[model samples]
Target: MTATARPAEKPAMPHFSSGPCAKRPGWSVEALKGAAVGRSHRAKVGKTKLAQAIDLTRDVLQVPADWRIGIVPASDTGAVEMAMWSLLGERPLDLLAWESFGSGWVTDALKQLKLKDAREIKAGYGKLPDLSAVNFDHDVVFTWNGTTSGVRVPNGDFIPADREGLTICDATSAAFAQRLPFDKLDVVTFSWQKVLGGEAAHGMLILSPRAVERLETYKPAWPLPKIFRLTSGGKLIEGIFKGETINTPSMLAVEDYIDALQWAKSVGGLDGLVARADANTKAIADFVAKVDFLDFLAEVPETRSNTSVCLTFKDPAVASLDDAGQQAFVKAFTGFLEKEGVAYDIAGYRDAPPGLRIWCGATVETADVEALMPWLAFAFEKTKTEMAQAA
Candidate 1:
C-alpha cells in the first residue's frame, strides 16, 4: 500500500499516554498557583486543602457515607500493596488477571505474599476471565480496568452482593471515566495521574465499612511496613481518613488534584466526565470501523475500555509477522505520528502485544482524537509503504 496524504489538521494537544494521561482541557501552570508549598502538612491550611480534596472526591465519586477514603503514600501501587499486605491471608483468595497490571498482582500474591491457597484465574490479552466461576466466598482481587489490553469489566454484575469476603480492586484507569459500583467493591485503589490527569506520587484508597471491619478484626501473619500500616492496636486509624497522612505528602500534587476535581465538577461532574470519555472512544471506534487493517484489541464490544483504547493491525501482512517484527512496525508507525506532531506515547505497553494504545480519558478532548484518526491513517500507510519498499 502507498502512503496516504498527510493529514491537514493535527490534534491541538498530542499527548495520548495511558498513564500521566492528558491533562484536563484548558489546564495550565496557573492551576497550581494555590498550592500550599513550603508549609508543614500538619498546619491547618495544608490539612484543610487535603480534607477538601477528600470531600470533593467523595462528592464526585458519590461514595457511600459510611465508607472511608484516604490519601495514602506512593501511587496506586502503594494503595494496592497496602490492602494486600494488610487485608489478605485471613480468608481464601481468588486472583483474577487478564493483562499486565492484573498479572502483577497475581505474582505478588503467589511469590511475594506467598499465599498458598490463593486461586488464580487468567485469560489472554484481549479476553476476560470467567467471572461466573469466581468464588465470592473467598477474597477477590482484580483490576476493574485492564489498562494494557483495553478490556474493562462492563459492570459490577459479576460481583456477588452478599459475598462473605472482600473485593479488592485496582481501578487506577477506570475511576473517573467508568461507573464503579461502590457498594459492590470493598477495597478500591487509584492514582492521581489516571482519569483525572493530576500530578503523580499520590494514591487514593477507598474502603467500605466491611473492609474496615476486616482490618480491625484480622491481622496478617507477615511483618507490615510502616507505610502500609492502616491500623493501630487493632483499631482503624481514623487520622489517615481525615487528612493526617502516615508520611508527608506533596502539597503541590494535592493542589493539582483539587484543580482536576474542580474541572471535573465544572464539566458536569461524574456524568459529564463519563460522557466526554465515551465520546472520545466513540470517535476512535468510528474510525477503526472504517479501516479494514485496524481493529480494537478488545474482541468484545461490551467489555471494551473507553479510557485506554488499544488497537491492533489486523492486515494479513502485518499479523503474519512475528512479535519482534510487529513491534518494529509499531515503532515506525508511532514514530511517524510523533514526528508529525499528531500523537505521542501511542504505542502499546511493553508487556502487551504490539499495537497502539490511545488514552480517551475525560482530559482528552474528542476533537483531538478525531483529528488524530487521519494522522493515524497517514502513519499506517506511510509505514506500510516503507516496509514494502525495504522488502
Candidate 2:
C-alpha cells in the first residue's frame, strides 16, 4: 500500500489512446467477415451495406429523420474542412479555440480559408472562452469536446434557439457519449474511431436543413475541391446522403462501423454509451477526489469531459515545475506504466499543457479504468523518487 509499491493488479486491457481508441468489448477482425472487400463500393451489395450503415447510424444515434447524414472522407478533419470551406465566407465568423483541434479550425479560418471577418474567441488549455462573447449573428464553429484538454461545453444552453447563423460543431470525441442539442446545431461532425472505437480514415457529416439550404444557395468565392463539394448544379446532391460517398471508401471500414452501430443498439444506444462513459470518468474522478496529488485539468467540474478525462499534478512539487520539467516528469511516470503494459498513450498532448489525458469513451471498460488508479498513484511516486535521487 506504500506509495513506492507497485499495484498487485494491472488493467486487463490498457489500450486507452484518445483516438482510434479501444475497440468495443469482444471486437475482432472476424466482425468484418461480411465486408464487400473485393467489389467496388458502387456495387449493389456494397451500396446496400453503405446504406444500411447510414440507417443503423440514424437508429442508434437517434438522429432526426430530416437531417442529412453522410459518410465523408478524411475523418473529422475532412468533415470540418468541408463545412468551413463551403459555408463560412457567406457571413462573418466566430471561431472558438480551447484545445489543439479547435485551434486548428481557427488556423483554417484565418490562414487557409483566409476569411478576413473571422474572430477567434479562445481560452487556455483547461478553460473555455466566454460564451457571452459569441456573436451568433455570424457563423460559429467550435468543438463540442476538447479531446486534447479534457474539457467540453457543459451543454447547448448557451446557444439560442433562434440563432441567425449556422452552428458547425466538431463532435468527434463527444458524439454518442454526450447529449448533443441537434435542434440548435446546423452541422455536426464526428468519426467512428472515437467513442464507438471503429476504424479510422472516415468522417460522419450530419447537416440540418439550414446547412443544406446554404450549400445549395451559396458558392464560396474560392474554388471547391471535388472532395469537399456537397452540391451539383446549385442543388444539394442527394446521393451522398444515401451512401454515395464523394470518392471510393474502404468497404471494410464501413462494415466495421455497421458492426459497431449494431453493438451500440444492443446496449441501449446513445443513452447506454453516455452511461458507460460517465461511469468510466467517475472511476478516475473518485480517485482524484481522494488524492492530493492529482486534479482535473478542466477548471470547472461541469466543463470536464467525461470521455477524454485530462488530469494535472496538483502537488506543489510537481505543479511548480517548469513546462519542460513537468513534461519530463510525465515521460518518466508514463514510462513506468507503459513498460508494465498497464497503460499506454496517457500522456498529455504535445500542444496542450503538461498533464495526463485518459480516454474514458464508451468502448473503454470502467473496471479497467478503476484498475488503473492505483498504478497511476504508484507511478507518480516512483517517478518523483527517482527524479529526486537523480537531481
Candidate 3:
C-alpha cells in the first residue's frame, strides 16, 4: 500500500552459488585459451600443467614437504570417499557430522562401509558437535567447515597431536579460505571449485606420512574401485600423487585449475585468500549487527563460517512461523533480490534450516558483498510487505 525506495546500487558481480562459485575477479573465456585442448592429458604439455597445479597448490597452501598432494577424480566428494575407502576399517572409526556433507560421510561409514566399530557424533544445523568428546584414539572423520550449516571448527586446538589414529578431514569448503592445521590432520580433501571457482569433478587429496603408512600396511576389508585404489603391491602408488592420474582427466579443466592457482599466487597465497574471505564475511557481519530481524544461523560467533555464511530470521514474526512459512519467507526474500539482479543463489541448503546462505569465499569481491547487503535489506522489506498483504 505504500511505495518504498530501493537501494541505489547493486553488486557488480552477482554469481555466488557456494559450489562452482564465482570465478577470479578478472577472469574471462580468454583465461582458458592456453588449455591443452584436444591433447593427450598424459602428454608432456598436459603433465607439465598438472604438475604446475600441484606445485602451486603446495607452495600457496604451504603444504609440508613430506605430505603427498594428488589430483584425484570427482570433486571433493570423490576425494573424501577415496580416503575413506583406502584408509578406514583398520581401526575403530569416530564419525562426526554437523551438516549435510558430514552426515553423508557418517552414512558411508555406517550404512555403506558397515563399520560395526564406528560411532557417530552429531549436532543440529548451525552448531558443532562436541569436539572434546571426539575419540582421537579411534580414527576420526569430520569436516573442518560445515558448508551447508555455516558452522566450522574454530581451530585445531581440540585435536591432539599425538593421537594414535589418523584424522580424516573433508576440508572442501575450508581449503584456500581457511588455515588448515596440517600437523593435526592425517588426510585432507578439497576441490578447486570452492575458493578458486574452477571447473568441478577434479578433486585434490592430501595425505600425511601416517596415512601413507596406513595404506602401505593396513587395507580395508571392502574392495576399492580402480580409480579409488591408492596403493599397489603393499606400497603407495607414487604416480597418483604425481601428475599421473589413475583415470583420464580433462586437460581443459586442469588448465583452468592451473590458471586459478596462478591467480592465487598473485593475491598473496593462502593468507591473502583468507583475508579476502574474512573481509567479505565482515561485510555481512556489519550488516547483521545493524539489523534486529536477521542473525547468523550459526549460534556461536566463533563457529560462524567465513565462506558459506548462513543467516536466519530472528524477528519473532518470522521465527514463530512453521517450517514451510520460514522456507516461504526465504524464497520470497531471495527471489526479490534475484529479480533486482543484486544477488544470486543465496538460498540456504535444502537440508539446512530455512534461512539465507551467502558465499563469502575469496573469489567474491568485498565491494560486491557490501553493495549486496543494502539490497538484501531492501528485498527483505519488499518481501515482508508482499507476504503480509497476501496473508
In order, candidate lDDTs are 0.95, 0.93, 0.92
In candidate 1, which residue ranges exceed 4 Å CA deviation?
Answer: 1-3
* Candidate 2 lDDT tens digits, 79-194: 99999999989999999999999999999999999999889999998999998999899999999999999989999998998898999999999999999989989999999999
What pairs collide in candidate 2?
none
User: Tens-digit lDDT track for model 3 on 1-391?
Assistant: 3454688988899987898899999999899999999888799987888888889999999999999999999989999999998999998999999999999999999999899999999999989988889889899999999999999999999999999999999999999999999999999999989989999999999999999999999978888899899999999999887889888899888888888888998998999999999999999999999987799999999999999999998888789989999999999898878887888999999999899889999999999999998787777778888888989
Model 3 error, position 271 (Å): 0.9
- Model 2 reaches what TM-score against the true structure? 0.99
Report per-prediction Cα RMSD to one decimal. 0.8, 1.0, 1.2
Best-to-worst ranking by lDDT: 1, 2, 3
Candidate 3 Cα misplacement greater than 4 A, ranges: 1-4
